[model samples]
Target: MDYHIYLAGEIHSDWRDQLRASLKEKPGVHFHFYGPQENHDLSDAIGEHVLGEQPNAVYKDLQASKINNLRTELHLKKADLVIALFGEKFKQWNTATDAATAIALGKPTIVIRPESLHHPLKELSEKANVTVDTIEQAAQVIDYIFA
Candidate 1:
């Protein structure tokens, strides 16, 4: 069996790595995980690197967002499933967008947001195939779904 999972969410924490570590390789099963560039500086600078400097900081952000959106669109298309996490530290509108894109593409989506965020994310979770509070539970759902 083969699976292509797009790890979509706040990159502030090591949740992606933790989830990867939790899912031990099963015999005859292969997992391919993909996500936005984990390097914050690199992800932020990619725009200027490829497109040259923008007029100002906000313009720089616009350039970065364009490229980032391109990558996200392509990855979401290729993903068999998406695990979108909404963290506590910052607002993650992009995470919600990614999950929505995955759903639009007909890919299964699993959302992770704490109970504290439950109300805010209710609509998104309603659209997602599953919602969990922790990466551990997300992994368990993956195991069950793809086992």
Candidate 2:
């Protein structure tokens, strides 16, 4: 059986690319990255706002739409487990929400935070089925548990 892992983390281009490449090495596991097709250079935001002006309602609506879409993709259908990757800082606004949704749905969840000592989503992370400090460790746990 194949395992579906929803990878959530910071949006920096290099970090994202590196993590994706690393996680893709896991055998029999599929990694899904949210918003991979979107432009990450703030171009999308700039295009949405003319002359640096965006309506608050428009922003809220777009965020809601994105969140709903993530829920549909990550929780309702695709993900067998959720993995939130963190670096030095734990900036997990949307990632935390997705993890919470996965837990609420009774699916397995894990957080891979290597550099963080105090995570903002500490409570939620602790409540997950398991938590590890690295993607490699997470992969090992997955293999052992799902083997």
Among these predictions, the greatest lDDT belongs to: 1
lDDT for model 1, on a 0 to 1 scale? 0.90
Best by TM-score: 1
Error of 2 at 20 (Å): 6.0
RMSD of each: 1.1, 4.7
- Which residue pairs does candidate 1 place in steric collision? none
Q: Candidate 1's error at 128, in angstroms?
A: 0.3
Instruction: Give each model's whole-structure lDDT.
Output: 0.90, 0.61
C-alpha positional error of residue 52 in candidate 2 after TM-score superposition, expressed in Å? 16
Model 1 C-alpha lDDT per residue in residues 40-117, reported as the tens digit of each score = 898888889999988999988888989999999998998989999988998898888899989989999999889999
> Candidate 2 residues 53-86, lDDT tens each?
4468578457545644554454434677777666
Q: Assess the local accuracy of residue 78 in candidate 1 as a C-alpha lDDT between 0 and 100.
A: 85
Q: Which residue segments of model 1 deviate by more than 4 Å?
A: none
